[model samples]
Target: MRIRAATLKLGETFIGIQLAKIVESKNPKYPVGQYVTAHFGWRSHTISDGSPINGQIPALVPNFGGLPLSLALGVLGRPELVRRDRNRCWWSVGSHVGQIAKIKGCKVIGITGSDEKGRVLVEELGFDHFINYKIADVDKALTELAPEGVDCFFDN
Candidate 1:
């Protein structure tokens, strides 16, 4: 099999492959030319029988609507599934998570170490509100920002 390394594990000579060509496959799930993302490790090629490792199976890359396939490595893949439950109040929003939450119709309140980053979270990232953990009491900020308490908390 041919692979394009995507993620690396410590001390491993090979890393996860984001783009791969199936030189051969006995499993119907994996066919030649079907691009897949899997933690196969840092190698130009590897062979597998389509077995799951630690319950983690290689997932097929879905259509990206003309978006880059690399986006599957992060934002467009798991994050889309992460935000499926809408109408929740979210806390400590990271940039990508916050944006995805908002797109999924969740109310987002970001927490940052600096006021500048907090401002960016609100102004640039479109978070509904931000708390500078350095300057404000987190407990107090949480109470004020989410009067009914947060429904979700995302730690970057």
Candidate 2:
């Protein structure tokens, strides 16, 4: 099928995608020249929608607004290339995961590297609790905060 391929443009190490041209008479379901997330490559370009990579796994291009395009290539795109739970947390990934989890009605307990980040996680993102791993004893905090035990612990 005609699809965009991420090719290392000559002399450049980065990749770009090749998007299928939109049939003019009807606007393609995925319009051309309009930015949308695709698990295309480390470089920038478009591709034609292709066969499912894995039947069990759906295509991932979680929407974000005003985010730099490169964030898609490096952070968002990397997960599709690997076998990792999308819910894992890191300094940056935690922020996104927390937001998504909250939307999914999951109570989030953010364990961040610093107290300031912890505060932000709770106040700004609506996390149920925050554990500053650098300052607070994680086990004690977690026990007090989530006495019921953790259903999911995402570590990034």
State every prediction's TM-score relative to the real structure. Answer: 0.46, 0.46
- Candidate 1 per-residue lDDT, tens place, 1-156, comes to 224234534555644344566777888998777777677754668777777743668887777788645455542223332332222223332577778778977788776667777777788778898776667777777788778866555553
TM-score of 1: 0.46
lDDT of 2 by residue, 1-156 (tens): 012224434555332332222333133544433444433434443334544422322133434586534334333223233222222244666687677678867777777676677778888878888776676777777778878866555444
How high a TM-score does candidate 2 get? 0.46
Q: Which stretches of candidate 2 lie over 4 Å from their true place?
A: 1-90
lDDT of 2 at 51: 41
Q: How far is candidate 1 from the true structure (C-alpha RMSD, Å)?
A: 10.4
Give the Å error, residue 43, model 1: 23
